[model samples]
Target: MTENLDPREGSLTTRPTAADRARALLDPARCRGLVPHDAGYLQTAGIEIPATRGFGQQLMRTRFYAGVYQLGRPIGLRVASALQAPGRDEDRARTARSLRLRPGHTVLDIACGPGNFTGTYGHAVGRDGLAIGLDASHPMLRRAVADNPGPAVAYLSGDAENLPFRDGVADAVSCLAALYLINEPFRAIEEMARVLVPGGRIVLLTSLAPGGRRDRPHVMVMERLSTMRMFGRDEITDFLRALGFDEIEQVTAGLAQTVTATKR
Candidate 1:
């Protein structure tokens, strides 16, 4: 229900012009599709940050890590280079199958980081299918585009809380390892529900409490960080149900659980 407004307009005086709306629509910030526009916008608004409290250093490292992970070839190479840690590969495969992605399905990958699951999703949908990966991080999206350049795949810089897409525009919506970052997770879920066509599916991959951890420090740390504003399995299921999703179910694969819901 968020309305488009121009930056120059007084509190509620003037409405956004078509040109302004188009520009805003094209803005990368709009692409994130998240709520609390301030958070996602500020995070990517090119504000210079000096190294302090480890935040700047962390950002650097994250950019680097994201860059490396975004490299689809390297990602595949790494996966191929060594056997996936116990249940890791199996988990991904299981999640993809659970989504039932097939030819002709149009997918919207919210918070798709470096096309990790995006690649698997591409295969699931086949050539006729379309996969749009939306993310707030431009650097990350750039890497994704560079690594996995091809037809039927597009990278969008947008938030999840307020998706830019029209109503009921996608057959499936998927967010992997990134949904927990949004301060308003439920709002994003509602938007996901809005964008999906009737009977369309949505998959949210996260480290739900019911899914026991594997004693990996990095994994634990990541989960802890995400938990800052994230919800547990029950909370997610309830939220999705409240958002009008039907047949909501929690499916576990290794340390991660995929919350599956269908548009009512």
Candidate 2:
């Protein structure tokens, strides 16, 4: 439900009514651990939210637009899958080919929404290997757990910037179509590097602007609504190189790019 705002007060007003604060404090989602516990009361109240925060936090504060996406997660994911079926299949095949996964190779899939690529990774790794799909959204994790069931596949709720894994524990790590949504892309990349073994592959697929064109309408909307920002090919390569990654290769498909690098 939308926040209960006073009729006399303008939308931009920083001061929230007592009822608004009370409603935010009593929201079940916040207490149920669906949202971050440390979020400020004003944020939870959906008033005067700052722009310098993670997309997950912003989504949580809004309850995914009054539970529209949350309630219809399966349908939303199905629609997304249908719309991107060909591209998603191609990306998965490319990733599978590039990673050349073997039996008993541990793989981590960050921001693995609905286990789209995570299941592919699991099958690639086979039963002997582990495939963990990690995402910050609880509903997404639930969908992933329900849809991608296997002994080798598991789902965990975790932040991409701060992965919940030991150092150099993975044979491969992948983050597909999600880096742009992260507030701290560098930190997330560093975490991916930290969890990867030497020579392990890191696969990333994300929206990119060719020739530094960041003025696209969709990009601007995402920036305003979710704090997302597009990256260039060279910018990403530089980040990878600085983090000890080598042999970086980028392949563009439409507005997104698939980047594969090896940890050195």
Candidate 3:
């Protein structure tokens, strides 16, 4: 699933072959009156994609952005964690376990780059359940459609600040290593809370903040290299507590943090 490195091919073309299949994963009633387009995804109107610009945005639109993790090396989990700890294979399993999913439960994967975990979630939920991946990047969504095709899975173009689904549409929601990329991450988490049903599980993996702030080019370069936002956790933890989530917990791995909670 590596994208073209050739400068001439800045981005991959959107293939139509999987559009029909992805369409089947959408529930008519679940959409906020937005129809799935011919390119094989529903989108939030006026929402810009890639979330970022320049190098990082280009990287995410391609397959190599994730660059591996505890269980997925090369594009979905902790890159440093995979390299420093045991690499790629345990990430998805741990995430699934945290969700405590059951067969036939619907799941929404926000910021699902390349739809990597979308396919994983689909399998976890089984045939009767639905797994929907949402990302603002068209190339990522198109590539996701090509890379991960399943009867129970689909991809859409949407902004994290405002999820496009109606209230309480998902039994579980997972956002992995993507919240930091959004401008208003806590607001996005609130949106995740809005789409989830009562007692539903939520899981997130994001870049961990450094112990203290610093004014240094080295730190800035490191942040760019890893696509991490070196912001602290007071806001996130406080927000979760205010939301009345149960079992809220956060764990660190390499440069990443895994946060799990349940809607009240």
Measured against the true structure, the TM-scores of the candidates, in listed sequence, are 0.64, 0.67, 0.75
Against the true structure, candidate 3 reaches a TM-score of: 0.75
Q: In model 1, what lDDT does residue 175 have?
A: 82
Which stretches of candidate 2 lie above 4 Å from their native place? Answer: 1-86, 213-222
Per-candidate Cα lDDT values, in order, are 0.60, 0.65, 0.70
Model 2: how far residue 34 lies from native, Å? 16
Task: Residues 1-264, candidate 1: write the lDDT tens digits.
Answer: 225454666454443322232233333533432232321221323222222132322442366767665433334433422433235456556657767788867787887777666666767776567777777665666666666544456565556776776777788888876555564667888888888899899998654443343355654565466343324547788888878888898865433456888888
Clashing residue pairs in all predictions, respectively, total: 13, 0, 10
What C-alpha lDDT does candidate 3 achieve relative to the native structure?
Answer: 0.70
Q: Per-residue lDDT tens digits of candidate 2, residues 91-110? A: 57778777767777888888
Candidate 1 Cα errors over 4 Å, as ranges: 1-61, 70-89, 209-227, 252-255
Residues 27-142, model 3: lDDT tens digits: 45544334566666667544455347445555666644433221244444435454443333466767877898788888888988777778888888885678888887776777
Residue-level error in angstroms, candidate 1, position 11:
56
